[model samples]
Target: MNMLHLPRIGITPDINDLPVPETEYVVRQNYADAISKAGGLPFLLPYHEPVGDYLDVIDGLLVTGGLFDIDPALYRQTSRKDYAMKPARTNFERALIEGALSRAIPVVGICNGMQLLAVCLGGELVQDISTEIDGALEHKPDQSASIAHHRIEISGTSRHLQTSAGEVHEVNSVHHQSVLPSDAYQVLAVSPDGVVEALEKKDGGFAVGVQWHPEYGVADIDTIIFETFLSKAREYSQKK
Candidate 1:
């Protein structure tokens, strides 16, 4: 593919302290692999001061899934549960997303990324789905990553997902926090249990967030989402 044809995608990495005394910035290979497979150039981005520097060079942003929860304080809530969160990473992503939005570049947030995006847009989240929503389906599946644990109904009016509202589709689940409906974005899809599974910006600028990990690319809908996002990125790059 010509260099000009492929949009540059900036992907966020998770910070981890696995080995004693050593902090590592890591990102799952699937994110980059999937972006490359979808015809975009993937670049891993780490948390740093002034994220706008990174955003200035990329055509799009991909906020990947992480194991920690964003501090509830950001969305103006308190939680009793003690879950790990990286304040630095959260801060950096917020800046990055803001920069992307200012440029009107396409941005996709997966899993925790979705929560970040929602919270960034004045939305709250159910910190713990099991204890919050009654009769909610199992969201943190113990099964293999390749398996779909639940179904989501996409909205017909959603330009990002491009699926009917009444149409149900199966998807892999791997998160405990979910988005709460807010005026910042239109609820694009939801699980039968009422968990927000997908959201799109109301003004329609190709900004979307999904509760599932579409980087896994396990379903046809995943391909559609990424392709549409990349198309938007391509348009932005051309305009630049």
Candidate 2:
């Protein structure tokens, strides 16, 4: 692809739930700005239409972060009252993710987006990290961008380690639920407390999910994550 032919990257939006008279579909500017800076045409994909339709147009899919959690029922677990969820958003996102994966399009999931990736792939979740895991570090960090909440050891054998350029790197943490150990996806990296911090498909598609929000520009490795995804997306677009 040429410089003028940037891939159209479809970004999933977060449903704003402020209990007002109106509902809004919001995509964080940072997400779009990052994709644009990385050489991809960022488009905000609303939840109004079937995701399959959008799959035929966009070259890549980016699942964004949200304040709500995913319903456990999607993974065959009983729903929890304490857990807050946006069924409409999850339903739409699940469709988009499944469609994108089936088409072999590059997909990147961040924060809750990562959890949705795990659940949609026949895997389970930690649900609540602090209460479920022993000695779990402070996965939830404040709004400060400079804070390095935790460190994740990139698995030497995992493809995602190539983005890190090293064995271990510090990241800004801002999530509670995480992927439980599973075979559906290869655990690419993990927090010191054993929480799954990063993952990629076991069968080797251009699908990757990170527990941290790379759009916020926290660590140096964040650039690699977006650059790699956009590069893969560009190649996919050229093949088409």
Candidate 3:
């Protein structure tokens, strides 16, 4: 593909606390590799106040998973347990998501990123599925990211069905918090235990969020998801 044809994908990095005074902004290597493999230019976005500045340059927004939780207060819920959170990162991501959606930019969120997206769209999170839902399967499995932990049944009405070869897809789960999408969003997939696994915008625009790390390329569906997002992004870039 021509360099100009490759859509610019702005990816949010994980904020990590270093022993020193400065904080580190980093993304997993596979996240960038996946975007590149999908024929999109991956750009790590730093935490900044002006979301428009970033939105103005990127054709797509990729919200990556992190080792923290979003402030439950953002979803009109109180914290049930103490957990680490980067308020600055959360604030920046919230603004970036809102700006991207307002401008109709393609977005794909993973794990905690998905949770934040749900919150941004007036949805809520399960907080901790194990505690909140009775008999919920273990969402955070103790295994490699490349291994499948569970299978999700894709909804027949979901846009995901277009790329999926079958209604059931084996996915690697790594999130304790799952999305409870708002009325504006449609639940695209769910686990056998009844936990939501994926969601997309009701209007059918590419604003998909998955509670698994698709960048790990755990399954064929993972690549399809990235391809679908990049395809939409390429379209958005061409119009620009």
Candidate 4:
């Protein structure tokens, strides 16, 4: 049996207007498509109160990019800089991640999702790119609105069994805030700047996070990331 592709992804809600009224919750499309292309079943997990119960059944988790920020209060901060673009609560993110790690489930956090993963793992965020970098970056590389924005270099062997070191992957860059002072996760890849572009769990866990969005227009979708994540999910499902 194919034992490395059963994924039940959990997506987060953004600040966009949702199809439902009163309580708002809507998942992104590209994220689900990416998992589907990689041979995994995607579940659009709505922003809810109790997510702990679902952790046991989920094989893998995909934290996606969106137009919101995690409550900075979680990091013990009061300065509200870009509150408009901040993502919703998603308080269940860390719990889900820890749950996955405990059961040996694969995780792939994209963009802000990546940042949250870092924070959950005792890492700090850079907060504002304008303050961190000297010059502005062309976050939107493609004019067509369908291509990945920037480039990233995968420095070491990823959790994905197939990807080799020194591989340069083109990803869509679409955020102003990022994670900095990352210690818990291994610096897997980086962009031109000293800013970390990608990170992997150093504890031999099958998990990775990328600052860029690959679900939109990454040339090789199944190359390493989705492949490794799905493979891990399949493993988790089989053990059940």
Candidate 5:
């Protein structure tokens, strides 16, 4: 795909609902760099009350990792450990993800973004990894991915996984919560510990969610993920 022919990319942004004179709601440059490199216009959307209004303004969506967690109540349980559950953000994230999926929009969800996708699809999450999985990969939210964690086996036939070959990727880890298996979604990849690493909607759609942060890697989202997404967005754009 030509860089000039890329479609607009919708990058979901974090919002602040509190009454404050100053707030920092920004999208990092890495996300844009990846999208631009892959040929896509960058569009960042905040937690607007009526999120649907902006659904048609972009060709694809990337749910970036953030400081908040999905409200456990989304899965029919009260908050455990009182995790930094952002109810409003969680609601918006799910709505946007579902909105995009309904239209067959090429979508990619990072750490928290993947969690949002899971809960939105009626799946549960292990809120605290330290408590559940001993010796779990370290997920430092504020720290940089300066170290290689572990390799993930990419299941064949998965576009996202096949992008990197049969080789296990030496990617960074920086998340505690993980997606629990769901009947509606297939586990595309997993950590050596048997944790759900990535998933795809078996119902049919260009969607995938991985627990790792692709944005922080050497080449964000890899060429295949971005190429596939860009190609889909291009096809969708030309049809319109």
Candidate 6:
């Protein structure tokens, strides 16, 4: 396919503080490379209020992970000191996701992005897995992104089973927070330690979130995720 014909995927950027008292919006190169490899054009979206305008231009949305947390209050939870947040980014992403869902745009959330997605969809998060869940595996394992930290059992009823080769797959985990099981969305996968590893929208419009950083491409399942997301984006583009 021509490069111009590739589905345009809007990727949310991480907001970082600069020493000069300003902020910078940045998207990791891995995300762009992964999107390209999956046959989609990655477009980094800045923090802005006009989410509808951004949604109007992109065929799909990829809410990338970041080293931050969503405010507990957003999900009706008490604040904890261990929680680190970037309110600006969270606010923008929340609006962007709401707008995307309203338009039936495909959305793929990664790590922190997944947490925020849960909150946006009337679900809550386990603020800190280590404290909240007994015997929870070390989720934030300090290792290279390419290294597998643990295994997650894919739910047979999940759409992920269509892309995943088997019921269980090794995945790299890097988040301290995990999504709580809720009726608002379908729990797609879970770690042996019982933490939620992946989820999808029940309404079935291609909304999926995985706790692992699939953009790292550590395993075949990672590639399948990007491919499936881009394929959906392609379908959306054609519909438009």
Model 4 TM: 0.84
lDDT digits (tens) for residues 20-105 of candidate 5: 66765667787888788778888778778676787776778888888777777787767667677667667787888989888877
Each model's number of backbone clashes? 1, 0, 0, 6, 3, 0
Candidate 1 — worst ten consecutive residues by lDDT sum? 155-164
lDDT value for model 2:
0.84
lDDT of 3 by residue, 1-240 (tens): 454778999999977788546878888899999999999999999888688999998999999999899998999999998988889889999999989999999999899888888888889989889898899999998898899989988763666436543478888988888887569588888888888888887664578888988999987779888998999999888878
- Rank candidates by lDDT, best first: 6, 1, 3, 2, 5, 4
The TM-score leader among the candidates is 1
Model 4 lDDT per residue over 115-159, tens place: 888877778776677666777476534464356666677676665
TM-score of 5: 0.88
CA deviation > 4 Å runs, candidate 2: 1-3, 18-21, 160-166
lDDT for each residue of candidate 2 in 1-240, tens digit (9 for 90 to 100): 465699999999987767755878788789999999999999999786767789988999999987778888888787555888888899998999898888899999998999899887888988888888999888886656457777888763556335542477778988878898788888888888999988888765688888988998887778989998999889888888
Give the poorly placed runs of model 1, Cα more than 4 Å off. Answer: 1-3, 18-21
lDDT of 1 by residue, 169-191 (tens): 78999998899988889998899
lDDT of 6 by residue, 103-130 (tens): 8899999999999889989999998999
- In angstroms, the error of model 6 at 228 is 0.8
For each candidate, C-alpha RMSD in Å? 1.9, 2.1, 2.0, 3.0, 2.8, 2.1
TM-scores for all candidates? 0.95, 0.93, 0.94, 0.84, 0.88, 0.94
Off by over 4 Å in 4: 1-5, 15-20, 76-82, 85-88, 140-145
lDDT of 3 at 216: 91
Clashing pairs in 5: 9-41, 139-174, 139-175
